[model samples]
Target chain A: MRRGIGFWTGLGFTLLISAFLILPVLASVIAGVTANQFVGLSSGLTTRWLVEVWANYGGTVLLSLRIALATLAVTLLIGIPAAYVLARHAGVTARLVEEALVMPVAVPGIATALGLILAYGAVGDLRASWLFILAGHVVFCLPFMLRSVLAVLLALDLKGLEEAARACGASWPQRFLGVVLPNVSGGVLAGSLMVVTLSLGEFNMTLLLHTPFTRTLPVGLADAYTALRTEMASAYTLIFFVLIVPLLSAMQWAASRAERLGR
Target chain B: MSVAIRLAGCGRTWPGGSIALHPLDLDIAAGETLVLLGPSGCGKTTLLRLIAGLEAPDAGGRVFFDGEDVTRLPIERRHVGMVFQSYALFPNMDVAGNIGYGLRVRGVARAAARRRVDEMLAMMRLDGLGGRRIEALSGGQRQRVALARAIAPRPRVLLLDEPLSALDARLREQLRQEIDALLRSLGITAVYVTHDQAEAMALGDRIAAMEKGRIAQIGTGRDLYHRPANDFVAGFVGDTNRLATPEGERLVRPEHLALRRSATGGFTVVQATFLGPVVRVLLRDAAGRELRADVPDEDVPAPGERVAVLFQGRSLETEAAASPA
Candidate 1:
């Protein structure tokens, strides 16, 4: 088929915007492997900067992974049931509660972290432990998990399915485990990916909440950029993308699979 | 095994005081198939849910299963099988998994559950399709899976709520016959709910015709057709024409009314519609009251012809007197 001028113009515009968005990330990736970012590609590529980054920030990376996984676990435990209740009630009260839960996401992360610190900082143990950082991550990541699960629940005939299960002699736990959980697997997958990725890269909130010993990857990345060589910071950025891209792709696959099953 | 059911003053009211079902008494003998037939929002589904233990009746109401009071029993303990209009099959499970879900939940062994699921698969004529996902099945096939799943656990009573309303007309008729045969072979007490009158007449051993949250009448198809207790049942069960008789207002079936051509008659034929088996002749009397008569195709009067209308049946008593007219 022959293309029209409008189609070509739109294509050009989209490509231009994509390049505009991706060019900096591409430069950072190239700089991560380059011998010296100041001299650009002519300086040649090497893995020394990546090795240096691992040697210096490996603890921060592991801490971020631990915090992200813990955040994922905490949010799933609390967010799923909260979403289920909200979806079932679905009245004025549910709307109010949902709005309140989403308030942290709507507010600036720094302000939310400040509020959390003020509320719990009086307790010396909580203020010093990595769990203090985990608490902030849970609050920040919960809305994503809840919203994803709630979307799936709202789309489903949950009451009808539950009644059918009940009529089949299944107990409440059986229905939840057998029917509700499996039906919402795609939503859970999508939410888990978002929570993990966001929690791993979260800087503003983590910076406010973290003790020196509890420094996360993004906080460490910021510190590396300010206090270390440019190539090392770029290597850290490259590492972050490497860790998150596969998870994002898995989420995409789950979304498409969900759409197919829905059809 | 089949079980008799009794609803003593069972009714339902929503949280805001809106009545969904008025308090009413009902009884179903073992192995009887009772159809609760009504239009949308007429409380037929609500009554069925009460019997299935999915809904609690209002205060002072009670439900019984085989002489045992189960009013407070939840659906999980009631052990009644239910089929919904949407088929409500678990999307995550294949046909065999869905059919065996109830048995599995009841602590049946995996091997036994598989055997029963296979038996149900064959019974529903879905022998080789047990491994197929729900999305892969046709509408009729999905309904079959749903039915198979509902009945696999051998519940005491079976409840179906507009189970065939979602299928196409040809499929609906075929499945309706299959359901009738299944109900008879199983000999399980079944409470079916639907808005379709033809379905009610075909499958119901006794049809409870409801209107505005109350049962207008309950009887066999013949009784409801020939001797409706009220005008609501009369008009709802079948097509009827209300005639202004000197004895008082009378309801007559269209088939029972005879139309004959005559000059200077009180009735004029306004429209003649040919409907293959019968020609429906519509007439307007001098009082501007419309009446319909289904006559043979060969003797159908043309439009604008004056005709004399004769009543073939006696006037039915108007006990309630407040018909939907």
Candidate 2:
């Protein structure tokens, strides 16, 4: 017998939507990489604009990497504990805390950036450093990271492992670092990858608060677009694709592995 | 090498005023495996956790390991090993790492830990499977791994919470025997929790029958089965047909009721099922009290046949309405 109408229809719909969304990005990226510079779609392969952008704005690209890495580190340090506590601690207080953590996800990113800028700018200190940008990125990404980590943590057999580790004479720290962390490694890695990708591509906050030294790749590309350089902007987008694709692919693979293990 | 564990007036009540465990007094002798037998919500697992120091009891409760007070000690300091019902082997670690975990926690050298793990694996009959990942192991294999992990550190006490409940019937029976032998060989005091009375009887030196956070009876398997102190214990320890009397109660086991060919007997067989080795006869008395009698398969009566049933004289005694003061 057939596997039912819903199953085939679902698969067909998924394939149709995936092609609809992905084909355009693929075609544009290819054209951006191949078209001759400044002539848009003129014949022949030419990566000359890519080379120039790399040579000139390599520093901005590295800054983006640093920002993304810093954001990832900060999110993990804060979000994991929050997620773990939310998952492990029982009672109404934990429920309230979980709800509060989820509130950030409901807020629009542009509004969050605006509020963060206003709040930090009101302090009138450290407004131009990477710290401000990092803080903003953290506020925006904390919800996703916490949600991701906490979902996995909630699914885990926490009490069982904790009891097993304690029975083994493991100290509290040893239990957390050895038993607990290893069990949630997939969740933590997934959260870190999310923060990295989001922070790297973040444009709203960076555009509102970009400086000479702290210009992220997205902000730099926006600035190049403002200057009416389509060839250059396309080149910058190509550069971004090159840098983000590998990390995104790696994260996707890790997530899929975790999902497969679960299945 | 028998160890003794004592709990003095132990009780636990949650914050919302729900009692998880009521005041309990128990003495488990060394080299004996005591199974706490009860149904769901009976707090058998809670009692095991309390003694293991995974949970703390409220005021006026104390636990003793070898006559030393350990009521307030955290689980790590209690020197007790607990096997979870789910087995809870660290999925990230291979079988060897999981078993050696306890040793590594206590600052044992890798060489020594591995050596102990090797012995534990061999004891659990998992000698060559140490390097295999826990996820790669079958359910029975994982259960053995969990047992090996708990016993590797050689703690003073071992607490098992429904350790064999996850296995199929054949595997559960086999593992139950192996586990009993292993516990006997190690001479470690063990408190096992289970809802299966058969398992409790087969594995326990003494069985504690619990009901609603209180111990109904604690005695040898024979005593608990043959001489249960109350209706709850009587009905729990075996298949007891509780018959209401004018004064109090009478509980009779299926084997205690004899089926014979007589019209003057207490009851007549209404139906009979030939259950391979034994025959089950359902009978109804003059007062319409239904009783079950188990007879040998060869003597089983046909459907709609008449059979006489008899009960021991002492089985007619009525149980007291109230629990012992």
lDDT of 2 by residue, A127-239 (tens): 77878888888887887789888888888898888878988898889988888877787788778887898899888767776678778898888887888776677778888
lDDT of 2 by residue, B1-325 (tens): 4469999999989889999899988999887899999999899988998989988989999999888899879999988888899998887788998998999889989899988999998888898998898889998999999998888888888899999999999999999999888888888989999999989999999999999999988889888877778778877876777655554566778877776776566666788887777788888878888888777776566655566666654462224433322
Best by lDDT: 1
Clashing pairs in 1: none
Give DockQ per model, in order: 0.58, 0.55
lDDT (C-alpha, whole model) for all candidates:
0.91, 0.83
Query: In candidate 1 chain A, where is summed lDDT lowest over 10 consecutive residues?
Result: A254-263
TM per prediction: 0.95, 0.90
Model 1 ranges off by over 4 Å? A246-263, B317-325
Candidate 1: residue B14 lDDT (0-100): 97
Model 2 clash pairs are: B2-B30, B3-B30
